[model samples]
Target: MNPHNARIEHHPVLGTLPPRKTIRFRFDEMIYEAKEGETVAAALLANGVRTLRLQEEKGTPRGFYCNIGHCFECRVTVNGKQGTRACLTLVEDMMEVISGKPFSSPLKKGGNHA
Candidate 1:
């Protein structure tokens, strides 16, 4: 994230930004919360979740790099939907999500697969 990307400010000329609302959902056995109007990536980020799916061969941890969903870095399963871009999908309360791969962060840290 960059300051150029988003700024936390409010001015008289600029309308005040509303606070992000929150929702709850389950990914695997874990129950996590998400913000209303926030993408799955944002919600996951808020909940200390940083992995989406593997990058095919050699499984790697891929999270959100581009929030706009063009990069396809945050694809995951949403309630049985496969290859759904987490960055593009907004979270719904009690929604189900699953990464294409499980526990690939270790691989990412190891950098065994690029």
Candidate 2:
């Protein structure tokens, strides 16, 4: 589904959102459009992207959880910098975001046991 389809243009409580300039950003080498001033996590969710990163130890998928920046589940690499919180970072035109990968953990099955 497209971001437009996933976005909530109207809400009963907040009502319809005002028109905002559309901006383009890259995520995982894929380009997507988002409203100006939108957070990376919000834009990703609007584009039907759920998996933000993988758990460092288990290599399990992670997405937007506890979006208030308290939990680092939405961490992603922005502009070549790692550990940027997707829920807190704003999308910029031509910005590049890369999904984070799990680090090698000895606790993981089949992982290096040294």
Candidate 3:
């Protein structure tokens, strides 16, 4: 099962899982399908997208770490807003999820573009 292009077919304990309603969303200009109500981070991981963003100073790759909202490691740009936490934000149809780089800059706050 290549997660990069398809959804999970089966799980060890859960067995074969039923397909959920899928929605279309964009990641950096490429369109991807994700289950409705799933977090951006979850969807990304499902699609084998680990690196959500990169660190500013060092340009280190960043991906989903905590899976929860605490760490903020899974930050991405939704629409035009910056610093959007992928783990906390649910997937929406037609939503533009940009793989923002450096996560957040020390210079900006409140809005996207950092």
Q: What residue runs in model 3 are displaced by over 4 Å at the alpha carbon?
A: 1-18, 103-114
lDDT tens per residue, model 3, 1-114: 334754566989999967788888889887778888788888888887879988875688988788988897877889899899999999999899987665355655556764
Give the CA lDDT, 0 to 100, for residue 93 in model 1.
87
lDDT tens digits by residue: candidate 2, 10-34: 9999999999999999999899989
Q: How accurate is candidate 1 locally (lDDT)?
A: 0.74
TM-score of structure candidate 3: 0.76
Best by lDDT: 2
Least accurate 10 contiguous residues by lDDT in model 3:
102-111
lDDT of each: 0.74, 0.91, 0.81
lDDT of 1 by residue, 26-112 (tens): 876688766578777777776677777777656777778888968878888999988898878888989999887744344455565
Report the lDDT of model 1 for residue 88.
80
For candidate 1, the per-residue lDDT at 73 reads 81
RMSD of 2: 2.9
